[model samples]
Target: MQLIRAFLVALMLCAPAAARDLDGIRQSGQLIVCANKNAMPISGIGDRPGFQMEIAQEIAKELGVRLSVEWIWAGYQARYTDCDLMLGVARDPKPASFLRYLQALTDVQVILVFAGPPRDVAFEDLSDKVVAVPSASLAHFKLLEIGADPRVAYKSEVAILQAIESGELDAGVVSSVALDWYRHDRPGAALFALSTDILDVTSHYPLTIALRHTDALDEADYHEIAAKMRDDGRLQAILARYGQTLSAEFDNPYARVPDEISEPDSVSVRKDIVEELEDLARRNREELEQSAK
Candidate 1:
C-alpha cells in the first residue's frame, strides 16, 4: 500500500511536467535575439536602449521567456545565422535562403547630410561634389543612380560622417532619426539637410524579425500579431517611449531601394543576375581545368 501511494505521487508530479506548455522553450528559458548594433533608434549600443530591444523584450515577456541579446557587427551577412530571431530587419517577403520570417515594425527615413551655409540643397546640385555613402546601403545605390563617384563610398555611417566632418567628403547620407540623435548630443556641429531630393522620401525598409527557414513561426503568424499590435496602439506606445513613432505607411528613402531600381521579381531579374554570375564562374573553372590538362 505504501509503495502504490508513492508511485501515484510520482505519476502526479511527472504528469504536470509532461503536460507543461512551452516545454521546448522553457527548457531553454531564453529567447536568443540578434541585433545590429549600428541600427540606430532600432538597435544600437549606447546609454539609451534602442526601440528594437524594447519591442523584443515585450515579445519575450508575452512568451514568458527571458530575452538574451547577441550583438552583431555592422555587416548583415556575418551574424544573421547565429540567433533564433533578428530584430530591426528590413522586410523581405521572399527572403534569402536562410531567412524564414520577416515582419516589419517601422519604416525609417534616409536623409542627406552636408555642411552648408543653407539648411537644404537640391539633389541635382550634388553632381560635382564627392558624396560619401555606406556600402551595400540604399544611400549608396541612390548615389550611384545619380552618378556619384564610387571611390567616395564608405562601409558604415560612422565613416561617412567622419569623412564629412573632416571635409574629406562633401556630403553624407544617413537616417534622420540618427541624425536627430547626433544633433541632440552635439549642439555645436552644424550639420544641414540637403534640399536635393534625388529619391522619393521613403520610409525605412519594413524593419522585421528574421528567423531561420526551419523555424515554427510563419509569416502569417507574425503579420497577424504585428498588425494587431499596430492597430491596438501597442507598437505606437512602444516607439513613443523611445522617442520615435511607428510609420503609418512605408516611406523611408533610406530603407529599401524602389522596385523600379532593383525589382524583387524572383523569376525575372534577380534570377538572371544569379544565373549570369554562375555561368561566368563555371566558364572560369572550365578554363582553369583545360589549362591544367
Candidate 2:
C-alpha cells in the first residue's frame, strides 16, 4: 500500500497544473496575460503599453475583470510563464494542438514599401528592381524564385525601411504590421506602402489570441466575443490607434468577407532589433487613403 501511495503521488506530481477557467478567472477578478517586454508596439513595459496590452485590456474589460500582465522577454519565454491569454499569436494552418485560437484580431500581410508618392507595383515589376528583404524570409525566397535577386542585406524590418527611406533601395517587402508601426513612428516621412495585390507569398497571416485548450471557453464563445467587438467597432478602433488595420479577407465579419488565407509553418520577422514605444497616436485618415494611391 505504501508503494502504491508513492506511485500515485508521483503521478500527481507529474501532471500539469489545471488552468483557471472563465468562472475561476471571474472569481479571481483578474485576467492574466503573458506579454513580451521588448516587442514594442505589440507588447512592452514602456510609456506605451503596446497594442497587445491594449487589446488584452479590452478583453479583460469584456470579461468584467481587472488586467494583470506577466512580462517576458521573448516568445520562447512564454512556455515558462503561467497566463490566461496570449495576444498577437499568428494563426497557422496547422495550429498547436495544446492551444485554442480565438477569432483573429487583424490580418498581417507582406507589403511593398518605398519612399515618394504611392503607385501600384505589381509583383512582376519587382523583377529588375533593387529591393531589400529580410534575410531568408518568405519574401526573400519569393524574390529569388521570381529572379528578382533582392538584396538580402537587412536583419530587421526597421533596417529595411531605413534603407528605402535613404534611397539605398528602390523598395522593400515587409510584414504589414511593421509598416503600420513604422508609419506611425515617422508620420512626416515620405515613405508609403505600395500595394502588392498580386504577390503570392506565404508571409501573410492573421493575428489572434490563444489560450490553452480548456472547457471554460469554446470556439463559439471566442467567436462571439470577437464578433461583438467587431460589430461595435472596438476592434477596428484598437488597430487604428496603432496605425494598423485588418486585411480585406478578415476585415469585417458582417460584410461579405473572403475565406481565410493559409500560411506556411515558417515564422516571419516580428521582433525589431530596436524597440520604440511612443504614445498611441492615431494616424490621419487621409494618410491611410493616400497609401493606396
Candidate 3:
C-alpha cells in the first residue's frame, strides 16, 4: 500500500510538468502578446484599448488563457520572436522574415483621402496634386506605384493629416480602417476613398499571431483552428465586438521560408538623420506658407 501511494504521488507531481513540456509554452496561465503602440485603430496605447488588443484578448480566452500585452515603441524589434505572439503583422510572402511562426487572421485595406471641394473625389483627378505620405509606410510605396509625383513624406500620420487640413498638401494616404474612425469622430472634414478601379492599392494586411517556430507543430494546425473559429462564427463574433470583419476574398497566404533570418538588429537614428528630416519638413512647411500667401 505504501508503494502504491508513492507511485500515485509521483504521477501527481509529474502531470503539470508534462503538460508544460507538451505545449512548449510558459506555464504562467497567460499568453504574452507584443504589439505596436502607434498603429492606431489596430494597435495603440490609449485610455480605451484598440481592436487588436481586444482581438488578442479574445484569442487568449479561446485558448483558455489570460492575455498579457507588452506594448512596443518605435524601433523595438525584439518582439518579432520573443513573445508567444505578436499582433498586427502584415503577411508578405516574398520575404517571410520575422514572421515564420505567425499565422494571419484577417485582412485590412489601405486608403487615400483628400481635403477638397467635396467628400466624393476620384483617383484619376489626383494626378495634378501632391499627396502627403509617411516615409517608409506601405501607403508611400503604393503612392509611388500609382505615379504620385513629388511625394511629400512626413514623419507621422498626424503630420500628414495636418498638412492636408491646412492645405499644405492636396491629399494624404492612411490606413482605411483608421480613416473610418477619424471620420466618425470629426465632422465637416471631407473624406473620400479613391476609386479602386483607377489606382487599386488595396493590400491584404493579415492580422497575425506568432508562436515558437521550432516547435513540432505544423502550420495546418493553426490554420485548422482558425478556420474552425471562422466556421463556427466565433471569429466573426469576436471581430464584431471590436467593430471589424474578415475579408471575403483574401485567404491568408503562407511561405515556406523567409528571404533572410537573423537576430533582431538595432535601429539607431543619428542626430544628423533627424536634422536632415527636420530640415526637409521645415522647407516643405515654408513652401506651403509661401504658396498660401
Candidate 4:
C-alpha cells in the first residue's frame, strides 16, 4: 500500500494536466461552456436567456455540436472542468490561466434614465431628481463621485427595467449588453428615454470570452457571429427594442483596438521613430565634428 501511494504521488508530480483538446470535445458532440450561473444579461441558467448562452449556442452550431453549460461558483475548475469555453468574464486575471487573447467583447459603463431626457442634463441637474444606481457597479461609484442622490437597487438588468417601469427608480445603470435582453422582454418607447453615453469611464472594464489555448476559434470568428446577428437584424433589433443604441465601444469596435493588436503596433511604430531620430542625431553630430575640425 505504501509503494502504491508513493507511485501515485510520483505520477501526480510528473503530470498535472491531461490532454483536453478541441477535436476530442467536438467528437463528443458537445461544447461544454463554463458560465456564471447568476450574472444577468451575460449568463445564468434561468428564465431570461443570457447573451453568453446565445453566443455559446452559436459557437456550438458553428462547431456542429450540442451546447452544454457547466455552472461555476467560487472555485472549481474553469479550465479542467467539463468546460472548454468560459463566457462573459471581465478583463481580469481569472482567465489569464488560459492561453488565448480575447479581442472581441465590447463593454462600457453608462446610465439610463426612465423619463424623457432634458437637453444637456448634467449630474447637478439630477441632484434634486431621484436616481437609482446598481450597487457597487461603476455607475454607482460614478454617481457617488458626482454627488448625485442615488438610490442603489436591483443587480439584475431586467429587474432594474421593471423597477423603472414601476416608478421605483427614476434612473438606473447596467451593462449595455444586459440592456439588450431587457429591451426585448419589455417593449415600450418611453422606457429608456435617456442614455448617458457622455459618462467618463476611462478606467471602466470590459467583459471577455475566454477559451483554452488549444481551442479552435479566434476573434474573427466571434466577429463573424456578431456580423451575422447584425445582418439578420436580430442583434440590432434587440437594441432598438429598448430605444437604446449600442454602447460607444460596440457601436464601432475598431474605435477601441484590442491591447493584443494595439500594443505591438505601438511598440513597432515607436521603435521606428526612435531609430530614425537616433540616425538623424548621429549625422548632425558628425557634421558638427567635421565643421569643428
User: How high is each candidate's TM-score?
Assistant: 0.60, 0.63, 0.58, 0.57
The local lDDT score (0 to 100) that residue 31 gets in candidate 1 is 63
lDDT of 4 by residue, 1-293 (tens): 68855654443333213324667767899878777776666677666446656666776787788988877752234533657677765544323344443444555445465644345566556655556665565556767776676776555566766776777777766556655556665545356534665444323355555665444455455556666765676654544543334334443433443443223323455446544655655665576578789
How much is the lDDT of residue 120 in candidate 1? 42
Question: Model 3 off-target regions past 4 Å?
Answer: 1-22, 74-76, 79-81, 95-98, 101-104, 116-130, 136-169, 184-189, 195-207, 210-221, 232-234, 241-243, 249-293
Best candidate (score: TM-score): 2
Candidate 1 lDDT tens digits, 1-293: 68855654443332211111234445778766777776666677768557778777766665678988778763243222335567766565346565554344565557778874555466666667788665655666766777876444465565566677778888877766566556555557667765225544343445556655333444345455566667788888877655566665423323343454343655465456545655655665576578789
Error of 2 at 29 (Å): 3.8
Q: Give lDDT tens digits, candidate 3, residues 209-272.
A: 5543324454455555567777888767765545566655225454322323211223335434
Per-residue lDDT of candidate 2, residues 148-249 (tens digit): 868875756767888898988888887788778878888877887855555565445667677755453455665677678778998788777778775454
TM-score-wise, the better of 1 and 4 is 1
The Cα local distance difference test for each model comes to 0.59, 0.67, 0.56, 0.57
Q: After superposition, how far is residue 95 of candidate 4 from its true place, in Å?
A: 7.1
Ordered list by TM-score, greatest first: 2, 1, 3, 4
Taking all chains together, the TM-score of candidate 1 against the true structure is 0.60
